[model samples]
Target: MNEDSTPQSSTEPARPSSGWDRELLEKLLLEALVEQRKARRWSLAFRVFLVAAIGLGFILAFKPLAQGGLTAPSKAHTAVVDVIGTIAEGGEIDADTIIEGLREAAEAKGVKGIVLRMNTPGGSPVQSAYVYDEIRRIKKEHPALPIYAVVSDLCASGGYYIASATDRIFVNPASIVGSIGVIMNGFGFVGTLEKLGVERRVMTAGDHKAILDPFGPVDPAEKQHVQQLLNAVHQQFIAAVKAGRGDRLKDRPEIFSGLVWTGAEGIELGLVDAVGELHQVAETVIGAKEIVNYSHRETLLDRVIRQLGTSVETALTKLATSSPRL
Candidate 1:
């Protein structure tokens, strides 16, 4: 080696033997952490899948028991179709579902009679009319199969409208059983908006399109037009009640004045045929002690969704204008 050229020192530090082992341990720990995360995710997914599967199985198991037409009881039985909520489209007590249950009960084997188990505060007039017409049709088709309305807590307005179509209306003495009229209600926020210095702007294709706007002043012409519409619907309601009840209903003006009445009062007014419970009616009236439910069963999720939708709709209706209801 030349005297002037000294040996060059290593620029890099000499790595310790433990450094490689430390890196390997760190890599292994990271891999273990990744595996743990993946495992936890899979476990959560499995739990969710298991819950969903159990729910599906539960629904499948109960569907046949709820809907009884396909597999009705062998012995004599009275079929019960529930009308136990607001009568509106897409509701638990909608016309389509009720009609389906009615048809099923009529077609079921060894069905002595069919009963409309009513407990509702009323809802859509159109929904009520659909059920009423269907009941009449079913009565015509199965004249021998006596159909009755058995009132529970309440059967008012649209509920009464449907009950009128039945062969007889039975109720407990304290049961509320009448409200044979139509109603349309809304708010008038014009004054409030004006006071608040807020202006409402609306665009409509026709002059009368916004006649029912909550933020608009009520025009006399529009009010009269709305009154005429209400009167027309009211007349239709009256006609249906007359046709169904015939001479059964008393000639009382208040009977059709949107007034609610107790079961006892309803009986006196010729609105209810008798005061009785479900079992009593089934045993004594239909003479079929064995009762089978034929109502559509809504799952918990379905009921939750439906109730949420109804709450939203009700809120919206309150904010805006409501259509005529019975």
Candidate 2:
């Protein structure tokens, strides 16, 4: 051994003190830590993905649990088409959907009868007429199959319009029955514009093009024209009700005067045939106990999109025209 050399133990190996080894060890440690962090992140991401997948599965699994799921029974049953909520174009209770449901129920095997489950404040006149016409056509095609309207909380205006087309109108004693009229309402913002010092300059090809413009002063001629239009629609509505109800409707002026009445009063006025709810109408009237829903139920995504579309459409329509409604 050299004089200055340090002696090593027989069992223990020599350890290096150079900075290179320390640097290498530190680099290895850093690499290991980074790998650990990456593994933890991957595990967390996987868990998040799993949770999201499970949530989606639950939504899909429970879709049929919603009222009036898009299905019918194999056995004899009363088909129900819900007319709940506003019955405007693009709405959940729109004419197209109602007509589709009616056609489906009429076509489906073992569907003894169809019940229009009415609970709406009513919406567009055109939409109402669409449904009413569809119901009449269905009745004409299927003379044996009885179609009935069962009013719940409310069945007014356009709602009643659709109901009138049914073979018989059943209602709860307290259910609101009628609003057989047409209206076109709006506000005149001319005074507000004057107070705000806002000048509205509008140009139109025709003289009556800007009729019922809220920002302009009410023109007597334009006002008269709008009134005439409303009256025309009102006559159409009256005609529909009279044609559907026929001799069942009482000879009363207030029936077509847009006055709402209770189910009992409606029966007296011949607006409703009897005082009965859905179950009663199904079991006693239709002679079917099992009630299968045939209504076109909207999915969550569909409802969201429909609501967005309806909002935009309504806003635009309000800006453009004060369209008549039932």
Candidate 3:
């Protein structure tokens, strides 16, 4: 062999040993690992930043979306409390509900003034009187807070009784105002029971226990007593109106003679302070440009719950009313 030829092995390069190959592979793998770690950190930071931004967005949107209807300004800090339907027992305008609504409105920090929006044809004297007393109490407690009553469709009898408690009363030009009186209505079923040969055996220790029973003949004395009571209630209503209206009331007995008047005539007769819509009254007269609804709001869930409760109560009432005599 030639001396120089000893230096040449093969044309192809020799394969590296396992250890050497592993070291080279490990070095490259470590470099790749370092790059992956850096990429992961950047990814984590970006994800965290995105999450924080989304969280902030949710926090900002939460209030407006949650309380959209309630938070929106109606141009006044005034709250509207609606008094609709009958004011009697089992009626929509019950004393408890009215008092609760008024109490909430009175206590609400956001509520600056109260607008009693009345639309009723009257109801039980007791129920009306209870609401009236509550209004008076709220007024006495929050003397600085102004309470304005706006008669919508009708504010007659018991409804007017409630409106009398407000600082000012405004009625729409077409609204029906006043019916200063008292009334009691019942059907006499004694003749029908007699015709049907249905004997109503009512045994009681007290002579007047069943005095007003519709199934029995009405006693003349009992009728007279009831009439006297009704008269007394009417006089009380008259006196309350007179006291509330003061000299604003045109001194006329016809005003309290169970006569309902139109909003225009009511203004002339001093049954109402002025004739205007609720918005106009709030904006122009009261100087409260913004309106907040202090009325009791029943959500769908609340309504469902209330309906269930009402059903249960009705069932109980039916059971009680249909029960046999004691």
Q: Which candidate has the top score in TM-score?
A: 1
lDDT: the better of candidates 1 and 3 = 1
Root-mean-square deviation of candidate 2:
13.1
**Model 2 misplaced stretches (Cα beyond 4 Å):** 1-70, 301-326
Which pairs clash in the backbone of model 2? none
Q: lDDT value for candidate 1?
A: 0.86
Candidate 3 lDDT by residue in tens digits, 237-319: 88777777788889888998899999999999988998777788777776776776655544454464456556545654553
lDDT of 2: 0.87
Pick the winner on TM-score between candidates 1 and 2. Answer: 1
lDDT ranking, best first: 2, 1, 3
Report the lDDT tens digits of candidate 2 across residue range 1-326: 78679876699877868999899988888888777766765665566556556656665776566543546777899999999999899875798889888999999999999999999999999999999999999999999999999999999999999999999999989999899988888898988898999888999999989988888888999888888999999999999999999999999999999999999999999999998889988999999999988887577855644565565456545534532222
TM-score for each model: 0.73, 0.72, 0.67
Runs in model 1 deviating more than 4 A are: 1-62, 65-70, 300-326
lDDT of model 3, residue 133? 81
Error of 1 at 1 (Å): 51
Q: Which ten residues in a row have the lowest lDDT in candidate 2?
A: 317-326
